[model samples]
Target: MTRSLPLLAALLALVATTPLHAEGDPESGQRVFNQCRACHVIENDGRNGVGPNLHGVVGRRAASIGTFRYSANMRELGEQGLVWTEDNLRAYLANPKAVVPRGSMAFPGLRNPAQVEDVIAFLKSRAG
Candidate 1:
């Protein structure tokens, strides 16, 4: 019973933090990510274009895109243990400069909440 209590607590915590995107629409997100495709690629092909390839960005450390010259601000975030999670992504996507002032992401962020959610769905779908 004592051990069971701990297990139940863990399960509850997991449930509480579970993503709303667990059943999110990946296709919709894919379409949204298309906007980013112009500046970024989310494939694992090691392609570095204007922005870094986001093949496995979720759960990855910020600014760790290999061979890509990140802004000093972004590099600092990477060194500060900033991992890419859905909430962080949403905030960042809403306003890049707001999240990281002087960061090098020149693209204007997605303004719609639904679009941001969809983008997160796409990123999660591609997470491997």
Candidate 2:
């Protein structure tokens, strides 16, 4: 048992240093936002596109943009008190359909965890 102590200590140290999710990079997230521009916009005073303008979406309730029509599922989720917290955004971005079944968002979800984090970071930065 004593012979394995050093190996165990090293393993624990490695695990402690490794991040479960990469810290988000807003700049990289800006580039990622290009993929969303066809359907959504994030700038203040930005007009709604195929989707609603997402100027202050970070803490906004789901389906709260009045100008844009939301699906029943999304509205229901919002009515149930679903706020767009970072953790909620992370899960939703990973699988929007899973988060709001039968929602109208047609794009497939972001599969890369780092990219999701970065996008969330960018959204948070622009949430003002």
Number of the predicted model whose lDDT against the real structure is largest: 2
In the range 64-124, model 1's lDDT, one tens digit per residue, is 8779998999999899998888778888998999888998788889988888888888898
Q: Kindly list the per-residue Cα lDDT of model 2 for residues 1-128, writing each as its tens digit.
A: 99999999999999999987777999999888889999999999888998889888999999898888888999999999999988888999889998988999998889998899999989988977
**What ranges in model 1 sit over 4 Å off?**
1-23
Model-by-model lDDT, in order? 0.86, 0.90
What's the TM-score of each model vs. the native? 0.79, 0.87
Supply candidate 1's per-residue lDDT for 108: 82
List residue ranges in candidate 2 displaced over 4 A: 13-20
